[model samples]
Target chain A: MRYSLFVGCTIPNRFPGVENSTRVILGPDHLGAELVEINEFTCCPALPTFYSTDRVTWLVTAARNLVLVQDKNADLVTMCNGCFSSLLKATEELENVNKCNFVNAALASVGKQYRGRLVRREGNRSIYEPVRVRHIIEALYTDFGREGIADRVRHPLSGLRIAVHNGCHFLRPTTRTSVDDPAKPVMLDTMVEAAGATSVDFPDKQACCGAGGGIRLQVPKLANAITKDKYECIHAAGTDAIVTGCPYCLYQFDHAQKDLKVHPIPVLHISQLLALAFGVDAEHLGFEWHFVAVRPFLKKVDAVGVV
Target chain B: MTPGGAPEAQKKRSTENGSSDAKSAEGGPLIVEDSVFTGAEHDPDFVKQIIRYGGKDVQTCLQCGNCTGVCPVSLKTPYKTRNLIKLCQYGYKRIFFTIPWICAGCHRCHEHCPADINPAEVFVAIRHIEVREKGVPRFIRDSTALILRHGFGAIPSDDIKRYREKEGMPPLPNTLPGYRKVLSELEALFRKTRFTELIGLETGEGAAGERKARERGGEASK
Candidate 1:
């Protein structure tokens, strides 16, 4: 299956490994999903900054990104939850004729248009459709079922316990994003298990990683405090490391431990874990870029020898 | 319902308090520590304005504590989703300037609110109103300026570029900032949206002028 890969801004810069791992996992020899890159894409414009400042501008900016993906004739697949939230939320808004027309007027200035993908007609009103936006984890869970994921694991990560952090943007605002259960999330755990690791349940399993909503960049003290809370719970669960689909959460879990001077728990993007299970070498996954070292995690997963 | 009914009720309650001290000395908004405003009048249109800005159910909020109980940020910060909504319902416009900025946008409150208030969305609506009234915070302005310049929020540092090269990936992903032509397209879009002006990045002459200033600074430093 072909899809447009949106790495957003953070993954390529803060966590290139997640993007690199995703590429390897979806390689032709592996899951065989073709990723079309739209290099002209910009930041998702992230909700906390753009939406807060000007909702119309945020919607127009996101619609521009969606237009690029639509031109590729492939479904949009985002690696970052922030990117997923921004794009998906804009897509929902653009369905209204007024919003679609308003966004199209702005796109017209840039020599583009947002002809929403799911267009239909009802009575007298023209119903434009929101584009199909999917987070990478959601795509992985749906496109490659658990059995299919299990079949590809060259080195099953048995004996390692991983805490799954399904960061808020991916699951919450349930009415809009129905990717998984918002309250009692099990999809991430199921995906973790598919890679042959035990997905440990922790208190506040669905809490924010404190890196979102400009919390980390703005009020860092509060952000670190929230990160400390998540770490406390993960520590209590006694998991070997944390796994998440969002680079922001992964960034928080990986870096905030060092910032808060708390007990450091290694963090990995879900795709990185899956890449390890698929027998890809650790060196290619960009583990060195991580603030908190993943050596202990590497050894626990038996991927150290390869590194 | 009387058009100014809420304000009339507020005024009557202020007189009923039996002490003129509750009113601000200069007749501005009065914010008693733990009580509803007895002197200041509620901006009767505030709820309608919020509802129009995607806080669709803010009016329907029953002030249940579910949104607060489920808010993870409230656990650490002084931010209470329920209290913020109450403040909005009471039409204390100035409170939006500070209180809503603390929201992490986790949306857990969106799911748990029995009133289906989606307090997180209400916070965004409040933020929108706040931005129009008082401008944005410094970090937000700096971050938006970065996006307008580089086409992304986070500025890529030298270390990140070196790491990307070592990993055999391109130093910069072929994105809006990586390609001049692509960045120009974003510039055109931003121009249409007044993105640069909204963020105050264009001091006098807009983005072109800012680029010239940066170039001058670069030469001076050299």
Candidate 2:
């Protein structure tokens, strides 16, 4: 139940609410999952921009973060889809003997080694273990199933309609990350439903939020155009809010709605929703930091007597 | 595969047609030189490098339009993922300099690719080649610069800090101790891989210098 929380770069800086809500919900008083922070961890280096540009450096950097978690002897749980994919992909690729040797040589220059899967002798026997990396959503879904999560909800979000965005890297490159089915993902929806909210099944539910691959930062017009499509679909679904597991997607939906001049709808991370359902104060969850105001959604949640 | 291997009949027709004045309506047909097929142009090394860089499924690409059909950016941009894959497989590395940047990395293409090509990863490989030879795009440079300076890609500003504090969270949560050392080590690693040069950090010579160096290296290798 213990994990080295990997809050990637964007979540901590751009979306502190995600970090705050995750900590609050997973704190000992709540779900009670032991969340440890490894300060040595740097950016997941972001897959599309950094990892794509320099594969060797990306592997080494991701391996360095993994090594830090290994130092803690804890499984890595990432809140950002980019970080989860980068670290998990690196961990999976480094399992190859040749790739492992290559990355280890690079790591050695940094005074680190990626002994990814290690064997330790315990008395007359040996135990082989590989580092486990999971996205926070997957960790929650697996650790606490629908009923388990529902049992923890003090105030159910009875009538709220939420559109779930699973973000690309969360389910994609499935060969590298088999967290959920790439095409028909239901874990995010399942988690959304567990909070007693209606998980609206919208068209293109699996589409990209347009923030991936640094698109939102670079060619923002195109990014906003893509985001507009997602918004249009969500709006058509008449959802009260958009809920996502990744911070980048949350940022995209939150900011792109304003940039595109679409009617702003509240966007919440799964942790924030869980915290709200658990009767945590809205002010404590950092809703004010959001570009799109969460008042409308908060009012709805409050109307449901969840606040 | 022979260079300038046009049929003799066509050559004679071109000679009779007066190729110099062929563009004029009064003149005969234009003589088009056959494109030379050089071993240097079709580099298997580039293909190998793409696979080496994690585009392991690039070779299995069936040239299906599934990637383009599913690509969201392809609808608005000139970045057709399938075309990029085809070009990458054929060792046309220059197309990747800007095309791959258009990819949003949605993985929709990866999901629908009948060949399991993982066009997203192929784009990543193309981006790797692009960065090494042609320098990274400005957006990538900016992101890398932030990470190098703050140990995070996005730095929380004073306004953001104030907001975070109001939300019952520390201004900077999980600030790594001695991040300066971490940045230095990361810079060293970038230098070893020439990433700093690609992103215009260490040498201050920007991508123009990297492009010039690559052109010179390409000529030398030829």
Candidate 3:
């Protein structure tokens, strides 16, 4: 389904290629971006809820976005695992009879209304949808007459043995919205394979990238311990690079790798790698969003070159 | 109705809740006693049940209040983990129902124990007794049903979610997503292991949306 790029605040602000690269690579392949605009969308109320206990207004404001998406009948997508969880959780919760009334009434004062609909967060996070669409929604619109995506791949990225790190929130989140086995999740690896790169099998493949919940903020020490194991797993995979779908995971892995005494492997968002492989310009793909600079590699050919 | 009402009540409750200058209130312990002679003393048979289930360890509790100091629920509510232990040690069964539901199962108490006793385990024992002997509160019973059915835990239904959101709730990620995956794998890896069954995760159909849920929790996918 053609979906809106419902990005959470982080993408447009901090790590932009999240959308820049997502659009650059996915655009040529036919994933059209329908941006969802809530007259005024606010934070999903994630941090405050952890310190104080409230869900009604959080769900109410969250539904404001949902109503906007439902107005267009497009699928909701977001790059933030947290926003994805909040929007989906808020939508599902607001749809319930007993629950909807209070949240809707709360929304009334804020001049927002939720009409029992779900909206995707912008820069839509990776949804492990059950049906695999080889060509994105944009591809359906833009690349209809062209050769399928496979034939157009200019660079196979064949020799790359990639390690896939599924961020904690992507799946196996404590509250919900995960699409794979939290313990042995395989969605990200599967996607990496679909993109024509070999997803290396590793012992800690299912471990988190240490960017989860409020762990990074609330307890950096604890976050470190979690990432420590994740780094070890990635190291064992002996891959050419690390590929993660979540922006936060990408950020955390990059940051954690910066101070490391060992392990200088590069970290790339799945889309950036895909864009580079598909013949998109490295400069345009927001390669600069990364804190840890990627190792320079000479491309054998341009991304669009069929040979 | 509105979620605000409870916070107002909680605020009023807090005036009473946090109002505790415990040293001035009771001097010895800010505790409620069941020794008012309700014609029921500790049931030996029930005490036997406690021992059979491992609550026999609570019998040695020194009443140091360390459990009270670090209780997961007590920090949130006016719950007294030490007092609950005393009640169990004194054979108070009526107060047993409300004592342990708030325990978060984090094992923090066990780690801090001077006696190597697990108050968390004792709390679990209380839950077990409630499950096996006395019936649990409907909400908790349903929550357990959903958890056991789905293999992960649950979140408040839209009712609570809306209330919480209106209250400007913090972002609390539900454990179900991670737990469900963890349980699904555990179910497969430990198909024959009783630990899976002991934890009440036997199947993964907990993902099934039940129309029966009223204030029922949300079922999530990864």
Candidate 4:
């Protein structure tokens, strides 16, 4: 289970906790997935804003990142929904003959080619391979089945209610990302349950976190309003905390909760929670870096006493 | 007609002379070309552009309002996905340009569209049109300039760096050595593709400030 980890801009620059926790949870002492960092990688360049503005630039930029992954000869796993969608969909689109040719031409000047799916011949035999891109959740779900994850939980998070926010890009535009049923997604919830926590069903579980599509930066009031509905639903569910696979959604939920002056609920990337269940210390997991404090929640978890 | 006292007599005279005057017989405004139908309000190329930009199924929208019903932002903002689709089909470029930005890109509309029109993609197509034909929005210009300059959209601040250090994490990753080469390649691609011009980067104030800041930061990092 080797993957070139695509820790897109948000996770590293905004929430190093996410990057730290993901690395720790997936390190040899825990889930043991081989995660490699490709230092030359740039931003996934974001999709809604950048991609919408210019398809060619979007395709070319995404292709450049894909070429880097191809150079490593490893599948790409991203923790950010935006990066996952951009890289995965770009890979799918670049597999098209015409789109690939056009993008490859653009890559030529940059000294790269998106030979997305290629066959090589050796000794009267041929080998075929296609690039694979997956979100960290999908990679986890596939690599370690539900029971496998459950077995690894050193501390079952009993009585810890969690509201799972399946951010849009993870399950959306289904044609590009078919990891789960877009309309009724349960992958994240299933993973949450596998971690020995209760995954509460909220009304806006599948709604946008008001941060996607550059709306947070563009029309922040609208973004905050949309996030307000999500918080209301999460509050209605009476969950202790929120869990999201996407860092942008984590930032939105974390930041918006403060801006709206609502009852503060801690937001965690799934990896952070998984790291907790795997018996990693809170300090190493980057809990202190969170805007909304996780100490109260951690105190409660400590009271639970590894049951 | 008694010193412009009767609109009927003035209308009659104007009709007799085949003159479409701006003022009525009462010395008020006349309603010329009011509520008149003009066949196919949009240019044919408008539909073609939307399709070309990946909204191939936009014309197939059934107007069922399913997209609008499911849109998260539509509830708070006036950004109804269905209305935007309708406007796009009708070739209402101005409305399409401004209204599509309100979409949060949640894709609920895309997921629920009975027609599978993928209204989100349609909105992206509309945004593409807006950026190319009009100009990129300020937020987009600022953000894009950041990526263009720093090789990352959000540069980790000193405070963030200090926090990462406290956490025992490695300093946040900066642009790898020879990042300038990669940045230039990207810029050239942007230039050759005319994305620079389309987003008004050639003369955009946002781009200029971002470039200056990037230069200072680049030197400082060195």
Candidate 5:
């Protein structure tokens, strides 16, 4: 299926590997996925701004992005969970209740507007394919048949103990979202297994990494405390590596290590881990893009027949 | 979503002789209404989401000074148990930032909230919505700058980084990009919505920078 890849803000400039891996994994599968980023798609500025409750500015920022998606007439795919959640929520709100009209009013000076129509009902651009904050390896298994996926693995990383940190807004948690159980998430864990790595079961794996969602700003102590708890738990699991599907979560776990006495566990995006199995350069995957050194964990990556 | 301070007409009425009179008159019990109260029509569902998200169920509590008396920081700030319930009952927007940031997150209020209000959590959700609207504060421009630019939130300038350094941080890599990256991203979003022309923000920092650049050029030529 054809789709437009809206890389969002954090991915391209900060975590370029996420964009690279998403394109790499999906492109090889012949998904015909296209990421034509509209110039000037800003921060969505969700980091700490979420406290404002000025839904108009936030919703309109999202709406403007949707206008670009609609203009391309392609389902927008994103790699960042925050971007996915905001953009997806805006698309749903605009199309369903039209709550986004006020956002349009706020954006009137920009000469941009959201028409609020999903192409699933039309002949083109199946909106259902818009997996903004998606796990690329999971998408391969779900979208492209997994019949030959294991064959693509250059090495099995079965021995590498891994913890999956699913970011906020990526999963359908509870009744507020649609997909899987938010309270007990297994999607990222299951996807990690397909890449031949053990999804080291850890307590509080589904909990937030303590970034974004205004937690860092609104409640810094709690955010740090919770992140500290996550670090301790992941360490207790004896996991050499931590994996996530969102740039925001990656930033949180990677950064939280700085403030606490947790073991040096390298955080990996699911795509980055999959690339490891596929023999992609750890450096090219933007290894330098990490604050926590990942070489300690990469040494654990299975080479040839060994992990 | 008709946001950003009440309209002049609405503000006139809210502060007018009518609403304040109504607020004190109805001091006994608050009722939800669809037209006015946010949780009016779907009181049960709204209350459930509030509780699920870790907030006080104002529906349960019989207001008492028990929460205020038990609160640790209540004396230092205007925050008290009763004020929280009053705002939740009204769905006041101001709590978006204050409740979370100022509370210091002891959860003592949640322990004391007679109505079972997790004031801390309500503040958190409010802050979440707030962050979605306004950008990060200017003070945190450095921390966010470190995270976005350096790839990790740990830097010597960053609070977390200072902690890590004292704790004997390993030679961590610096993944943060130039500050210009953040500027361009914001400028792009603002440009997308033509937010400047729309909100009349004088086009944000980029324009301010441009103006400075032009002045510098004028000085150079002189």
Candidate 6:
């Protein structure tokens, strides 16, 4: 159950609480999965950044990060969907011999090369074992199934109604992925229910949070407009809070509520929710950095009491 | 429907009405205007560049509105991916620079496209073309510079650092800011990839700052 923890940039920079909660929940005492933190690891070079402007740089940088993961000899587990998407796409691209060689040529300048953990060859085509990149939800859902999660919940959140935002990159470009049904995602919802909260279906459940692809940075008004629709839908559903696996979505939902006229709802990363359900206090989860106060939500959890 | 199916059908409907300004069965004006058939703005190489940059099967797009129907940005903005792809196939290179940047890159259109057009990937190709032809946007340039300098897309603020310290975690996670070797390696990779040049950072204010830092021998090593 050991894996390399790729927090990417957002979790550590904007929300260290996610990193803390993730480590606490998956640490030796909880899931007993050992997380290897490689100091040499850099950003996943998120797709919205270099992948859009410079494909070669994006592929080379991502290949370098994968080289570090391959050196660790463990599957890469990321808390950010953007990281998962970039690393997974890079792995797919690097499977081609020509692209791999081209990236290796660039890597040579930095005294590194991407071998891709070559496994075998088939008719002049080299089949390399791509590094398995998984999102935190996928790791949690697969490694510890719904029953495993339900069995461990010490503080059941019975009265809570959650809107699970799967985030676009987690289940999209659906042709290459099989984690869950992209259109009607149930992994996050089922996990939310496993933790004792009722998962509510919202109108904009599958819509993008409008934070990805530089929309939040470039045209924030449009981003806010898109997020506004999502907020209204979730607010209409009467959910106590919004839960998501992607930091970008969490950031957008948590921060965008300030401008919208809808009621402010607390946004939580899935790890933060699971951590609270697993009996970790709010103080340890780094809820202080959130744009919206989490105190009321904490009080609600307290009122629910232990099951 | 095939690639040319849309225009051919439009031409047939207009000829049946015996006028260029044809009325649809619904008694409204034609959706696509006659100006679209002029090919005055067409640049065939744009489509080839898009295909080269991993925008697969874009030419096979049936001009179906499925992409626009599923696009979240299209819902709010004037950025319809269906129209953008149509323009791309029609070889309107300049149009890509304006509208493609509005894409939020959700990839929903890619998921729902029956033609397997992958409009999201097409948008990325257009973004690359935009960056090369026109300079990177302010926020993108600033963020890319941060990655070049700190080996991360973002840097934690002083308040964020204090919170981390209060929480009994390292103020800085084990990323580039914490390791000079990793930062240097990333800088070398940046040079090798010509990322700075590609993003327009090599010449202009960005380069001057680096030059000045090197002259002072201050943060260049950083």
Compare the candidates by DockQ and give the number of the best one. 6
lDDT of 1 by residue, A1-307 (tens): 7788888878876787888889889887689998786777878878888987788889888888888876565889988888888888888888788988988988888788988664556788776455689888888888998988999998899878999998988886334657888868777888899998999877788778888887787667777888888799989989988999999888877778888887788999999999999989898898977899998898877753343
Docking quality of model 3: it rates as: incorrect
lDDT of 2 by residue, A1-307 (tens): 8877888777766677788889888887788887776667778778866777777778778888888876566779988888888888888878788988887777777788877545687898756455788998899999988888888898899989999999988987346557898779989899888999999888988888888887876668878888888899999999999999899899899889888878889999999999999888887877766899999898889899934
- Identify the runs in model 1 with alpha carbons over 4 angstroms from their true place: A118-129, A173-175, A303-307, B1-42, B162-178, B204-222
DockQ of each: 0.36, 0.34, 0.03, 0.35, 0.09, 0.40
Candidate 5, B41: how far from true, in Å?
28
Per-residue lDDT of A104 in model 5:
66
TM-score of 4: 0.87
Candidate 6 chain A TM-score vs. reference chain A? 0.94
Cα lDDT of model 2 by residue, B25-99, tens digit? 222222222321222223446778887777875768887788889888877665566766765666645334434
Interface RMSD of each: 4.6, 4.5, 17.8, 5.4, 10.1, 4.0
Distance from true position, residue A245, model 1, in Å? Answer: 0.6
lDDT of each: 0.76, 0.74, 0.50, 0.75, 0.54, 0.78
- lDDT string for model 3 (B41-149, tens) is 2343555566665454667888888877754344434446776776676565544543324444334455456876667557656665665455433333233344334
lDDT of 5: 0.54
**lDDT head-to-head 3 vs 6, winner:** 6
Better candidate number, 2 or 3, judged by lDDT: 2
TM-score per candidate: 0.86, 0.84, 0.52, 0.87, 0.62, 0.87
Which pairs of residues have clashing backbones in candidate 6?
Answer: none
Q: What order do you get sorting by lDDT, best first?
A: 6, 1, 4, 2, 5, 3
lDDT of 6 by residue, B1-222 (tens): 122444555445445553433221223332343423223334668889888777875779998889899898778755567877877776666544434356777778877788988898888887877887776766566667777666777666666667667766644644335578788788888888888777667778676654443343233122
Q: lDDT score, residue B202, model 4?
A: 73
- Most lDDT-accurate candidate: 6
